[model samples]
Every structure is written in structure tokens, then in C-alpha cells.
Target: MIQLQSIVKQFKSKNGVFNAVDHVDIQVKKGEIHGVIGYSGAGKSTLIRCVNLLERPTSGKVIINGVDLTNASIEQLQQSRQKIGMIFQHFNLLKTATVYDNIAIPLKLLGYSRQDVEAKVTKYANIVGLSDKLASYPNQLSGGQKQRVAIARALSQEPEILLSDEATSALDPETTDSILDLLLEINEQLGITILLITHEMNVIQKICDYVYVLEKGKLVEHNTSIDLFTKPQHPTTQKFLNTISQRNLSDSLIEQLNLTGAVIRLTFVGESTGKPLIADVANHFNIQPNILAANIIELKNGIVGNIVVHINGTPSEINAITKYLTNNGVQIDMLGGTTNE
Candidate 1:
């Protein structure tokens, strides 16, 4: 429902002109939660801002539902923006206003009747689980509660597309999870297309259907969340995935520990995650399998299993085991191991 085509946002600095967001293209399908991820200064925040023309691109098309926002008139852009809501890293709520009023502000500004404003404010406040806190001011609420207020305010606009610019970054881990869960529910129940930018892979892993990896203002990789997690192509993407998965074993650590035989990384997807492939390899190959590190990630699509194992066996035995595992739909990476044919 949202398309950002060849987007470029440049800024004049002491060093000369630099692209905060380079030529990037992103398409967010309707009703799907799409995530943009990058570290600080990776241009993720700038990229999301370009979506709503909050930071107009130097030269690109910002299309929403087939309307090129870049070419839209002032009135048309203002009307279009009403349907695109945004929440920020810091809960941007009026401290002087109560939660109810905070949510009602948008409706009131849009010239809704007093009764209609009350109805929408109440409805969205409840949707964001802030019904009871409607009377509370910003200072009286916790970080999560404040974000709920922000969400309620945004939803009160009845936006078709929700842009979350690191909305959960300021909260604690537990609060972040709760907020992410709330966003997932909003997407599923309201069918609002969500485009959120976060540096946290855990957030993307939890709710995103598709993911776009940004680095130094460039779109390095974009793929289904499942594919990105299982098979990350770019080094930057791999770096991000490593943050969530213990798939990397340092060469020095391996050397210091003097790990023997072959060291391999195994990836199991879907039903393979439930299989006894490790056990089968041991029994069938008559080789010992020592697990170094492992983790199971539950994605929106399915479960992904990652295992790093140390094995001691002859070349023939290791090859046989690799073949056996491969035939059973397991992905094998030679971490520091005998090459598998």
C-alpha cells in the first residue's frame, strides 16, 4: 500500500553534500508488518521519515495507494497525511493533557463533533489498553503507558498506514515486548499496514513479515523475515542476525579451546526443527556430536533452529553425516570443519 521509489535525501554538511538516505526503494504490502533495521546513523530513522514526506526526499517518488505524494498539492498532501499516522521513539504526548485529551486532539483538530471525538478517543484508548489511564497525564504514566497514549492518539486518526520510528527503543525489555505484542495485535485486528524502523533484531523477529536491512543509508538487503533470518546474504545482514543468534564461534576461542575434528553450523526450519536429526546423525554415522551453542527462534512464519556442533570423526563418516542431514532438509555451514560433499 506504500511505495518509496529511488528515494534520496541529502544534507549539506561541513564535509559537503551527503546522502542521509541514499537511493533506496521499499514497498510495504497492505496489512503486513514491514520492518526496517539498522544501527545508529544507518539512516533507518531518516528513511521512515521520508515515507510520510516528514523529510522530503531530494529526488524520488513517495506513493501511497497509487497516489504520488511527491507530486501532490499542499491540500492533497495534508489530506493524504491524515491517513498516515506516526509514533516516535520518545512518546510525543502533551504533558499538560490527559490521555483522553491526548487521543482526542487529532479528532478535534480534524473538526469532528464533540460526541464523535469522545467516541473515537474512548475506542482507541481501549484498543491501546489505556482506557483506565485516560484521566492520567503523561508524567503519571510509565514509558509503556505513554507509548500507549501515543498509539491511541495515532489510531484515533483512523490511519491506514502506521509509521513507527523506533517506538519501542526507549522502553525496557519487558515493556518493549508488550508494546510489540500490542503492535502485532493492531496489525492483525485492524489490518493496518505497519512500517516500523528499529535497530533491534528481536523486535523484527517478533512481528515483522518482511524486513529491509539498511546500512550507511543504503538498502543492503530485503526479504521475507524467515528468509532473512535463515539465509542472510550481506555481511551487514549477517552482523545483525548474529546479534540475535549465537551462530558465530570466534576462531580464537576455537583455537584456545582446542576443539577437535569438524565444527559445523546446522540450520533447521519448520518441521525439521522438531526432528531428531542430531540424534540420527550420531546413531547412523557412529560419530559423537557435541553441541557448542544452539537457539530456536519462533518467527511469524515458523520456527528456525540453529545449532553449532563439534564433531570428531573420519572424513568418510563426516561426509556421510552431512549427506544424511542434507537429505533430511537441514542446512549445513562449515564453520571450521571438514568440507562436506
Candidate 2:
């Protein structure tokens, strides 16, 4: 439903022209929750802003549905923007306006009749679970409730696409989870496509169907959440995954170890997970395996698991075990020690 082609947004700096968003392309399918992730100053916000022409791209195309927004006239662009709704990290609600009035602002701006505006605002307020708070003001609501007001206002336009630019970054973990769940429900029930920009992997893991990794204003990698978690290709992607996944043994820990066996880390995915494969391997090779650390996380696709173990055996036996694990779809990495490849 949304496509960005070779998008570039440059700014004039004292040193020279610097690109906040370099040449990049992204395609978000209809009815899917696509996430854009990066650290601070990585141009994630710039990229999302370009979608609604909030920051006009210095070069390339911004296409929504079938319309090329980059070249559209001012009137055309304004009309088109009505179908695209955006929410910010800070709830941009008018403090003086009541909850009902905040949600009715968008409809009123479009010149809707009073009866129509009230009807639609009531519907959207219910959708965001704020029906009871209609008479409340922004100051009286919690952070989560304020966000609910922003969401209801965004949906007041009945947008086909929702752009969330760090919408959950300011909330606590429990509040964040609730907001993500609400977004998923909006996607499933309202059939609206969502493009979320976040730095937190947990947020993406909970709701995103696909993810695009951004670093230094460039598209580093993009893939389904399961595939990306199971086998991240880019070093940047690996670093991000390590933040949520179990950390590797530190050099200090490794130095303190007093084992003479080889240490290996195994990653399992899909059909290879949830099995006593470690025990079976030790039994088959007639070698004892000491489990060091392990963790299993469930994703949309399936289970992705990791295990670290130390084992002692002859070179020939280690070689056979490596081959056996490889054939059985287990990824083996030599963390430390001399192990057969």
C-alpha cells in the first residue's frame, strides 16, 4: 500500500550537505504491520515523515497506494494526506479540548456536519477503548489514556494507512505492550495497514509481521521477523538481536573457565527446535555434553532456540558430531576451543 523509491532527504549543514535519509527503498504490503528500526540519528523518523510529505524528500519518489505524492500539487497532496494518519511519540492533543472535542477536530476541519462528526468520533473513541473518557480532558488521563486519545483522533479520518513514529517509545513496558496489542487489533479488525518506527525489538517482536533494519541512514536489511531472528545477515542486525537474545559468554568468563573440552553454541529453528537433540547427539557420539546456557523464544513463524555446551571427545568423533548436527538442521558455531568443522 506504501512504497518509497530511492528516497533521499538532505539538509544543508555548516560543513556540507548531509543526508538524513540516504538512497532507500521500502514496500509495505496492505494489511501488514511493517517496522522500521534504528538507533538515534539513524533517519528512521525522517523516512517515516517522507511518507506523508511532512519532510519532502530532496530526491526520489513517495508513492501511496497508486498516487505519486512527491510530484502532486498542493491541493492534491492535501486531499491525499487525508487517507494517511500519523501519531507521534508525544500525544499531540490540544490540552484545552475535551476528549470528544480532540477526536472531532479532524472531522470538523474537513467540514463535516455536527451530527456526522459526533457519530464518527464516538465510533473511533470506542474502537480505541476510550468511550468512557469522552468527557475527560488530556491532563486528567494517564499516559496510556492520552495515547488512546491520539489514536482515536488519528482514526477519526478513517485512514487506510496508519503511520506510527515512535508512538510507544515514551511509555513504560506494560503500557507499551498494551498499545502494541491495540495496534494489532486495529490492523486485524479495521483492516488498516500499519507502518511503525521503533528502536525496541520487543515491540517489533510482539506485533510486526516484517521488519527493516536501518543504520547510518541506509537500509541495512529487511526480512520477515522469524527469518531475521533465526538468521540475521547484517552485523547491525546481529547486534540488535543480541540486545534481546541471551548475551554471549564474556571474555572474562571464558578466561575463568577451567575446562579442557570444546565450547560450541548451537542455534535451532522451526522443526529443529523443542527436541532433546543435545542428548541424542551426546548418546550417538558417546560423548558427554555439559550444557552451559540456553534459551527459547517463540515467534510468529515458530520457535527459535539457542544453546551453549562443552564437550570432550576425539577429533574423529567431533568431526562426526559436527556433520551429524549439520545434517539435522542445527547451526553450530565455535565459541571457544578447538572443535572439528
Q: Which of the numbered candidates is closest to the native, going by highest lDDT?
A: 1
- Model 2, span 47-66: residue lDDT tens: 99999999999999999888
In candidate 2, the residue pairs with backbone N, CA or C atoms under 3 Å apart (3 or more residues apart, or in different chains) clash, namely none
Model 1 agreement with the true structure over 22-134: per-residue lDDT tens digits:
99999988999999999899999899998889899999999999989999999989989999999999988998999889898888888999999999998998899888998
lDDT of 2 at 308: 80
lDDT of 2 at 107: 95
Candidate 2, superposed: residue stretches over 4 Å from native: 339-341
Please, what is the whole-model Cα lDDT of each candidate in the order they appear? Answer: 0.91, 0.89
Model 2 Cα RMSD, 1 decimal: 1.9
Clashing pairs in 1: none
